[model samples]
Target: MKNKQEIPAVIVADAKVFDYLKEKVGERKTRTEAYSDLLDKSLAGFISPFLRKQDYDLQPCQCHVTISDLATEWHWHRATVRSFLETLEAFGQLKRTRLAKSIVITMPVQSGQSSATFVIQRQPDFAIQLQEVLSDWIVGKTTSADVGNLCGQVVHQAMTGMTGYESRHCPDSHIDTASAHAGKQEEEIRKTALGCIAHAALQRVLWKSRFDDSSPLIEFFRHDLDEEWVSFIEASKELAELILDTEACETTFDTDDDKERLKSLRKPFLSLLARTQEPAD
Candidate 1:
């Protein structure tokens, strides 16, 4: 869990997709373009207050955007926009603060997201420390300049090292084998318990808020991610929500520097998370 985490920001306002959105006005919009447009709208000109509270302490790239506003902008249904924002938060791409009925997102750019947080030192596993970013790079959830960039670097590092690769299968002693296998099994069990705890915590929060039913979390993952990755991503999203709660929900900036310092501090792990199967990045 301690690794060099990355938040992809390859999305931009300039793309053929941008032209497509304009050409097909009032038509469907891709997650990429919708995110770009949202950032653009938040930075410039006054975005009319559509929330219950007209007064917002918003900064350059921070604003309170209603699902309705996003739907109209992207020509999509309100439900679609709301679902996308929730997905973005799951991927840790959006800095969000959930309100009574609205959400505030602080989408910062450049050095605004830097942080100086303490990182837990990891125990050695003879694993190569080759990492710059780790993500599935889904089109809308996130993007990358080249999805294969990290893989190439990993190969390069291994080939350049004393050994092309290091996978020695020395037989483990009985005690060692038992410990390792038991630990692996326990880890899985703990993750399951954690995922349930996270899901229930979210549901309880919504229930207290008078939400009739808050089951979007269950529904979204059923379609967005592979079945195996559901618990992983959900747990990660809950962790992100907790981190967001420690920061300013939304605020007015006295200066650009002041705003930059207030940007989301996404401190990744000290080591890359181990992938046992498909996410073999």
Candidate 2:
């Protein structure tokens, strides 16, 4: 185990880190002041090397912090402090447990956290795309009330695009009603399957934004996402590239083989989509 003195400067000091801290602090504080304050507050009595080596669930980290103390120290709202702490826990940057009266936080080994590599992309076009897509699906052009309605509309469009099928009526030539019913069922299945494909495409677009260790998306959606979501976000960039490749395929018509290959590739995304669904009554 490396002592604090032996810890590399690369991990301990960076000018960019102070900029990030300043942004999170969200007040009039300058970068220098933020850095100085952060050092004063967080570094003293910080978790030691021995604490990191212990089994956290059995022998928790020695650092115990209250949310109110953090809120006051950081000049942030109590709710914001709570959310930030939860995000840290989700990222494996810290461990949090609830006691009978208060919350206990345990700082994790920072060296382990340095292993993640982040790729940042510049997304100048996504804001326009999101607005356009949302505009197309939502009606009644303007109202504060309608802003609340947009969430449902976006979800509804995704679900509709995923499950919509053109229902076919029985033809006179097909005298068998049972055969007609089976045909309808098959059509429904096809529609539902195609909807899943569309939903995957939507996801590829939605989360394909720029992300780094310092992204605010981590803070905002932190409650719903975890460190594992980072991998999914990274994979979506590759998925977007694959989508471009498929679109540019020279074949005018897709063969059964191509269809099966696409289905196999999308299986994981479809499974994730299933997990996101609300349980039915």
User: Which candidate leads in lDDT?
Assistant: 1
lDDT of each: 0.42, 0.39
lDDT of 1 by residue, 1-281 (tens): 74566522222233344445653334667665676676565555234466635666776567677677777867777766766676444433456777666667865432232111000001010011211232223212224445346534433432322121111222335446544544453343334333333433443333333422223433433543455585646444543443456344333345665334323212221011111111211
TM-score of each: 0.36, 0.26
Question: How many backbone clashes are present in model 1?
Answer: 5
**Model 1, C-alpha of 134: deviation from truth (Å):** 9.2
Candidate 1's C-alpha runs over 4 A off are: 1-26, 49-53, 111-281
As for model 2, its CA RMSD to the true structure in angstroms is 26.6
Number of backbone collisions per candidate? 5, 1
Task: For model 2, give the 10-residue run with minimal summed lDDT.
Answer: 115-124
